[model samples]
Target: MDLHKLYHVHDFHSRNFLDTYFSSKPDTPFSHETLMYPMEKFHNAFSTGDIKGEVLIDISLGPIIHHLYSAQEYFRDIILLKPTDHCIIEVKKWINSRTGAFDWSHASTFVTEMAGKSDQCEEKEIGLRSAITHVVKYDPNQENVTAPIELPQADCLVLWGVLDVISKDLDDFVGNFRRFSKLLKPGRCLMYYGALNGSFFVVGGERFHIVKYNESNLRSILSDEGYVIRHLEVSQRIIESDLIDFDSVLFCTAYKEQKI
Candidate 1:
């Protein structure tokens, strides 16, 4: 059974996906891993003042923007690329402050508190919203993921839980990485977050396929693609769940040494 095909056939409910894994409450292990962990990593990485750039390209799974709360402070412009219309609409809804948009106050509060600016929670959300200048749809299979309108080479690229979901095999993963690299300027940064050794994750009770690979595989791929790894952190799963099966979470920040 082609799991990728099944993923396209099913309607990916953006709201359901959020409620399942990214609830405002961080009581569950799933929320901790998916929401707080990434938030903390991004906060720490950007705090170094190394990842700041003029334009940041975000290619993440679903309509999730919790991880970008800190990034907005560093990047002048943010462009989001979504694979599905469902995801795109959800993002636009939030950008427009439309009805039924996912409340990201919890994420904003977390980031503000981390920066010792708990009183600036609303200011953080406003900054993120203003920084996100564009939300475009992209096709992962294409040679130019954002074709037709050539985007300026970004100073930083964020690939969060996207490669594993789109890649069918190890080779495909490498190819996707190369394609994504073209969007970033040489000597810039690429911040990646993904599940390590993950095969599947359930959203709206529908299991979606993810390419399983270990830390060594990811490290080799990044090195082969001419990226210099600066920071790599992996945390073992705190709890087991029927919704998703994975050994650990990996957060990496690397610089593109040269054009891939």
Candidate 2:
């Protein structure tokens, strides 16, 4: 319900979103294991024998490209959609290769490292920049999130923390994802990442609320949305630290089942 609190410039740090989440700093809650889990699962699902296609649509990208490092290897075009101007501008800076763009270089190395590939951070940056052809502002309040701007149905949908955190309730969560699934081509794949049993997190010393959903609710919603689970994993917190307050994280790779 409180979507606007931590996203404002004063609360959110667009500059450090990547480094902050995927940190080498001492006792970063997003440990090497936490960061590596999704990447490894993605590598198995997609990098190994997963489907490939042209467009990858991302909503509420926040400021991290960590999820898309290996994905850029397969997707010819990546579209970054943001809910706010600040998020859009920050992502555009990196897309345009500006001088002070947030460094996503670490994402490339870490993603490739997870896949047992040699260091290719520079190549990874080039790949992402070249693949991401559009950085557009999306209005979620509209009947269609991409309204006033027509976008092709994507081959794959990438959602990280958007559906779970933005919706005010379970019904809102269901409706939001339903809209998102419409943007995906039928039978195409969807990759999702989000907090499990999390309601709020600290950013800039302020508390931000997130929708709390469990495994059963998530499965029911996905099934209602016509997704057939190809892979699913839940990683519980191995240790307690700081910055994040979620008990677990959900990683899912599924395909949109075609209507009969």
For 1-260, candidate 2 gives per-residue lDDT tens digits of 45534342233665656555666565666754346676666666677746688899877437666677777778888988787776777888888889888765655677767666656667877887888888877766677787889999999998888876567778988888887888899999988888888776666566666778988889888898888998788888776766666788888888999989
Flag clash pairs in model 2.
199-210
Q: How many clashing residue pairs are found in candidate 1? A: 0
TM-score of each: 0.95, 0.90
Name the best candidate (by TM-score). Answer: 1
Clashing pairs in model 1, backbone N/Cα/C closer than 3 A? none
The TM-score, computed over Cα atoms with residue i paired to residue i, of candidate 1 is 0.95
- For model 1, the local distance difference test gives 0.88
Which RMSD values do the candidates have, in order?
1.7, 2.5
Residue 15 C-alpha lDDT in model 1: 87
Give candidate 1 misplaced runs (Cα > 4 Å).
Answer: 1-11
Cα displacement (angstroms), candidate 1, residue 213, comes to 0.4
Instruction: Assess candidate 2 and give its lDDT.
Output: 0.75
lDDT for each residue of candidate 1 in 72-171, tens digit (9 for 90 to 100)? 8788999999888888899899988899999989889889999999999988888899999999888777889877778999999999998988888889
